[model samples]
Target: MATIQANDYLIKVDEPWTEFSKFVQSHHYSKIVILVDENTRKYCYNRVKGQLPFDHQIIEIKSGEDQKSISTCEFVWSQLLNNDCDRKSLVINMGGGVIGDLGGFCAASYMRGIDFIQIPTTLLSQVDASVGGKLGVDLKHFKNMVGVFKNPKMVWIQTEFLDSLPANELRSGYAEVVKHCLIADKKQWEEISKYDDLSQINQWTNIVVDSIKIKNKIVGADPFESGLRKILNFGHTLGHALESQLLETENRLLHGEAVAQGMILESMHSVNHGKLSQIEFEEIKSYIELIFGKLEKQRLDINDLIYISKKDKKNFAGAIKISTIDKIGSCIYDFNISPDEIKSLFSQSNFN
Candidate 1:
């Protein structure tokens, strides 16, 4: 078991189920509620049920990006109210990014704030989403356009939950792992790039630990995302735009999938700005394509992508500011970009 102190809360990664059960039994919460989706309700809850000796309500929401909205938050809030939850009630968020984001928001808003614990199940959440205190839902086509900063009481991560993950979902989660490597650890990037298979959990545990440590250290320094923390937005500017644009379409991209593409595009931006070498840029792009595949068939509109990117949270005073890597594991932030630059990147035939 590894523990990292983030903000005012403690994050416990890969801890034993017995330790978690004991934690739940010892805490004197007035009431307990678990927020889960259809996927977690079926495949994840049983993995933790044996440890809970107290009666707790389960709030099940739909399991996708489409379901993450103000309406969903209303439903979750109403459930808590209907159940007579008070200021001291504890909420356990058990699922992936969607669950942790929306559920943490609900717990934060309920009674002006209450205690919530994060139990992130998927590989993506185990490393990224559950570590930081970013909680929110998407606003229309803008990703994370509405949110608040509220840390959970504690975060519990267990790798056993990964056993039932679908192959595509597994690959999707790897994108965040790759993002961590690119932004903070060059050696990890070199190590993970040669992997032909990700079928084993033990092979991934140390990587996950390293990723969480990177996030924890950054968040501890800049909790509200005012300065150095912006580096963490490395691939999110374009990645979030793509995720938002594709949400209602036939070819919806998972969070990590979009992020993988964003990393490639931003790495190319580094090349254009003379910060990264062309050879290193191609190597990054090629490795990403080999793992996450190419999006050439999508034929995305440059104008539409530009419009969405203009609305990215990273923009300052209506100017688009993006984060790019100067080298593997090292990032430079707050550079202005134009629509033509965005168009130029999208029009390139290289990614295909």
Candidate 2:
């Protein structure tokens, strides 16, 4: 919908490959690698394939949260080596968040680094992960624990790629959109919550752009997550812990699905710790449930979830670091909470 030029990289939205093609022509790369998981390779790859002016290598990995691992990175690295990739080579990440994370990490670590572009194929990557320059694979279920802050050369976002997604995937990405509104844009949040049917409102350009602007502004302000960027993790702290904890189970959650629920509990925490009113928390919780359905946990062990969360990279010393909102559309970061507090979150929830 719009072209946003950051301090270094450019994000092209819905304008197709005009800017991307121009940028590629200027950069004389030794090789080009297009990274995809099976899902995107089958669905999203062919769209961009015809538009690319140069011949490129297609590297496919399995698609899933579980596949976002060091082992996958090794496989990508091996493929890169087999294709004679070098520092001058380029990697085009052409999938959802997992591909963006894994592909970017591979490109960044390949011979100390190479140029890479993000062509985020799913809404999750499009609005959040792809633009942030945060790249890495998960370390043993703890989400994004082994990542780096390295921005891509550019990001190309097209809404058409989202068309291939199933409803659950779109619902997963909508969690971040909801998070964006909850943390930074109350007006948008109010509007989004009023949706009669989230899926029926087909045009997502405005919505995606809005979330991108909110996130990109925050990331630009605090590129390395030194301070302000942690607000972006508002729902992610407890959300990630729950996500990691459920991975061993059959009903493991999609990243955003977990974050959506995380927001529900974190909203409760906000009322307890910050200025968010009970009315506000209740409203937030109700809206989330209306959209994503209710929290359903049969045997979630709070202690194990806390143990997994303790490994979060954002945590400092022994205190669990998180971001909580003072109110809708605003947030504070570097907030620390105790394990007792987290257990209380579970105890207070409907699931417990």
Candidate 3:
């Protein structure tokens, strides 16, 4: 079992579901709320059914990024209010990033605050979303425009849930794994890049463990995001913009897919700025595109992307700041770049 000790939060990785039951039994929560979407209810709820210690209420939202909004938060709040949920109630987020983010936001805003647990089902959530205390929903074309930092009491991750994920969904999560290696671990990058078929669930358990360790170390040092923790936003600047801009469009991009693309575009900036070599840039871009195929050729407006990117939470003083890597496994955060530079990078790709 891998355990991450945060300030007061604990992340248990690859642990048996029974541990969750015991933990629930140990607590005297007035009520329990398991937040899921239709997808999770169909593929995940049953896996943990036998291990739940309490009679919990299930709040199922529609499964997709479309449901991640204030309206969804309102619906969740209404559910809690209708059920007479008090501050003592525990909210268990039991799905991928959307569920975890929306559910956690709901829990944090309800009655000022309440305890919550993260049982991240998807690889993306298991390694990235669930660990970070950042919880929010998107606002218009902006990603995570409204959110807060509040740690869950515990985070339980089990790889068994991955067995039900579709191939595309599975690959989407792998992109986040690659991000972890690019920013924090060179050895991991070397190991993961050599293989093309990462479909095996057993093969990913350790990789997830290592990813969490890197994230937790960064988070632990800068829990409030005052400094070092921002490095975790490595590819997220453009990734969030791309994800949010395409969110309402017919051709939407998954979070990891957009991030994979973001890494490529940002690597170009790194090369142009002389921080990353053309060879390394091309190598990184090649591997990412090979694993996660290129995004569809969609005509995009450069100004639209710039506007959406300006909405990134990391931006300060009306300037766009992003985290970039000098080389594999070393990252620098909050580096400011020009919109012209971003446009130049986006121009390199087929978008627009």
Candidate 4:
């Protein structure tokens, strides 16, 4: 088992087929429940279930970003209650970010919190969503508005499972990997830049492990998202707002895509503030654009940007706290900027 120690939490990574049963045996829970989405149920459930101890209950939810809502949590909570799942019962989140987020939220709330494990199957969940232990659901189309900060007992990452992910999802997840490198590890940035394929499991293990270490180190210092943890939101502020705004559109961007665009725009902001050198800012944009492709500039309604920015969780005292880059592997948070400035940045070319 590969273990990452994040302050009080320990994330255990194991081979999903053989090692999961061993984890269960060691814990010796009274009951085991597996949470999955329709897609995971069809593709990954049997492969995982076949390796589990017998007689475990299974709960399934409808798949997609639309399902990561309070209503889904209600359904999951009902299923857990119907199963008589107590605090001692263990819940296994057996899908990507949505499953891990909603399932962890359910486990954390049920009976005032229960033990739950994350079996993150997608690259995005493995590197970003699953390890951080940030759990929440969407509220009225705003992303992750109603959520909690709760760590899981363990997180099992099986790169073998990436085989079933769609190409777009894989690309979306790789964006986080890039973000990880940009925030703290220049060596990792160089390494990931050399690879174009994300399906290589062997190569991915080290990348995932390194990314987890960077996040764990940061989260260890600020587990409750007090100050330093906010750095992890490097590209998320505008990215999330844009992602939320585009969620209902046919050309909806994935989380990583939104974040990729966020990184570019925020890097530009960093340059504008004189925190980052023009060369450094351009380097960041160049690499992201190389991998993510050119940002597709759209005429976003400035009023909508202000509306979403106002609703951002990071907003305090009626001021928006934005994150900007100082240099490679370094970031600063709580930097305030005006809506006109943001609109000016958005109007510029190459900031998709």
Model 1 CA RMSD to the hidden true structure, in angstroms: 2.0
Clashing pairs in 4: none
lDDT of 2: 0.86
- Candidate models: Cα lDDT each: 0.84, 0.86, 0.86, 0.81
Q: Candidate 4 regions off by >4 Å?
A: 14-17, 196-202
Off by over 4 Å in 3: 296-298, 349-352
lDDT of 2 by residue, 1-352 (tens): 7888865888888885766777887898889999988889889887667788877899998988889999999999999999999889999999988899899998999999999999998899899886677888888746677988888998888987888899889999999999999999999998898885677767888888899999989988988768998898988888898887887788778889999988888778878885789988888988888888876666587889899779887889888988888889998888877888998988888963
Error of 1 at 37 (Å): 1.1
> Candidate 3, residue 133: CA error in Å?
1.5
User: How should the candidates be ordered by TM-score, best one leading?
Assistant: 1, 4, 2, 3
Listed per model in order, the count of residue pairs whose N, CA or C atoms clash below 3 Å is 0, 1, 0, 0
Compared with the true structure, model 2 gives a TM-score of: 0.91
Native-referenced Cα lDDT, model 4: 0.81
Q: Which ten residues in a row have the lowest lDDT in candidate 1?
A: 196-205
TM-score of each: 0.92, 0.91, 0.90, 0.91
Tens-place lDDT digits, model 1, residues 101-160:
999998999899999999988888888887678899999865577889888989998777
